[model samples]
Target: MKFYGIVVFLAFAAFAQGVPHNGRTKRSISDNLETLVESIQALASEVNEDLGIPAFDPFTDDSVAISINQTLAKLEGELTDLNIDGLSDFSIDTLKFTLIGLKFTFAFTWPNITFSTGYSIDGTVASILPIYGDGKASGEITNLAVSGTVAISVKNSYLYLKSMSSAVSLDDLDIQLSGLLNNDDASALIAAVISDTVPQILVDFQDVISDTVNTAVTEYVDDYLGSMTLAELLALIGS
Candidate 1:
């Protein structure tokens, strides 16, 4: 999910800055931000390909790790050797950006997103259910919304992401885990419990997600912007 957000953010950022390419019209700096965003959205595919931004539809990760802590379910464990897929097929219901000083707030909603993963978890569910196995997990989230504030800083005329804070919420979620337990009923029950609890868990651990996004985005954006000279950047935007 974080990776998906990062790609989308960078794609818009690149388009807004008017990264130059062959046969593309240069955008004037005097154009309003709203107009620029509209153009970006319309030309998203073209710009993403031209700028070499990672595709947002159908994103995948070969390996990931997540810690599970659910007091209500009495679940405490870790998911390792996890492979995640299907982050790209989403509809952007809304995307708004507000800029003030060196800070900007970005709000967006993905109407629907479906994903699947393979994982191995060692945990205890419902206090009595021992969950230790390798399995496949699949789910869909409805109305996933995110709002974030980003602070930018300049050093040696290069822009860097100084900090970021974000909040995430979803209207609904459904998940299923298979091959975790020998009994089908038990596995289905566990899956139901997870589906119900995950939304709240995301809210509880939002800070961790924000910190991770900040670190990763800052490094990537800083490196990318630093590679270009101020003059080159300005030129791209027709300044």
Candidate 2:
């Protein structure tokens, strides 16, 4: 029952830290982003839990839509310009990130075989690349350890930083719980928690969880902490 365990997956961990504006430095973007990461991680788990769909219940279709809408709203509000660029360095190509998007919507319209629904921001962040924006005055995130990509574009004063991740895996979680319960009843107990509703759930909630996490990560890299420093940037960040 490794289903309850943390599955390893590739992430867009690219980010920036020290930010310089008009030759002066500000806060560490990486540190602030870490906070966002924490929130996304927790939320992803929650979404996975809510994917309780029973084929017998076609009504689950609408509920699924409502859930996605709710999640999108939460993500959009979370990063209302929280200056993600300030926390990023972009010093290298394929920058890895833990946080940073757009009005990306994805749907899995498979017939009688899949029920995956998702959306993406935009851009790619690698797990190894490090980079910073051009200009000598620009500061960098110190000790900025990352794991994925943080890609963004500037349009109409707004920074659309989106994170993309794939390469994922699902595992068994019954290992840890093995001893918690007696030998006779332990296996069944673990199976019940990790098991899904027959054909209703397949490949687990990995995609849904990944998308939710991606949204949060994208928001983290699109911070507006430094926006207060400039009116033009502020307006952009607010958007």
Candidate 3:
């Protein structure tokens, strides 16, 4: 969600400074903003089709379990070697852990889930930056609320239940460390513990992640489309 917020900010920033440069045709700000709105609506639609129908399950065939371990191993190494400046009581050098093996069980019906509407986006004018590209052009997005109704009945859905091995990637991770513990080396300990534990935890919880993402995407899309600022058009990405 934080990442999404950042993306929204970037999109708006680009809109503000957008010009007919790089061989692109000129478009008014309103046109660009409307495009952004349409993109979101399209997102909702795609989420409904892809996730709602179970047409795309990254972990469906046990592929996730097998692939995630290697990524976890690399993360363990990187965190172990990470160097943080001004570290008096903590060092991110001691981080280490082995990823836990994972398995999944699913009883998915034809339409494993249903989304009644897609997500909604709203922000106060006050949250927008009066000036662009200066400081905090990362303008705040206010009232960015998302609401939807998702129905998931995997338990009642008659289908196959299975588990598999999988692997996940952790790319370009920007790690940050903070906090102090009673004049002690808490930060180092915390980083070490996290580096050791997070991978295993993620591997163990892959199934939950899959189901939650699926439900959230579809429900938000279904609920949001009804009130979308733009009408549904062709697919946003691949058609």
| Top-TM-score structure, candidate number | 1
Per-residue lDDT of 1-239 in model 1, one digit per residue for the tens? 35645564655465446634434566435343335445544543343655555544355566665555544333333444343343433444434433344565666676777777776667675477677766778888887887777766667877666777778888888998886765567778888987898788778867766666566666766666665555564465445
Backbone clash pairs for candidate 1 read 56-88, 57-88, 58-88
Which 10-residue window in model 1 sums to the lowest lDDT?
72-81
How do all models score by TM-score?
A: 0.66, 0.27, 0.28
129-239 in candidate 3: lDDT tens per residue?
Answer: 121110100011111112222222122222111222222222112222333232225544544555455545656766654454444344443333333221111122101
Q: Which should have the higher TM-score, number 1 or number 2?
A: 1
Q: Candidates sorted by lDDT, descending order?
A: 1, 2, 3
Q: Model 3 off-target regions past 4 Å? A: 2-168, 171-176, 180-184, 227-231, 235-239
Residue 44 accuracy (lDDT) in model 1: 36
| CA RMSD, predictions in order | 5.6, 20.0, 21.4
RMSD of candidate 3 to the truth, in angstroms, is 21.4
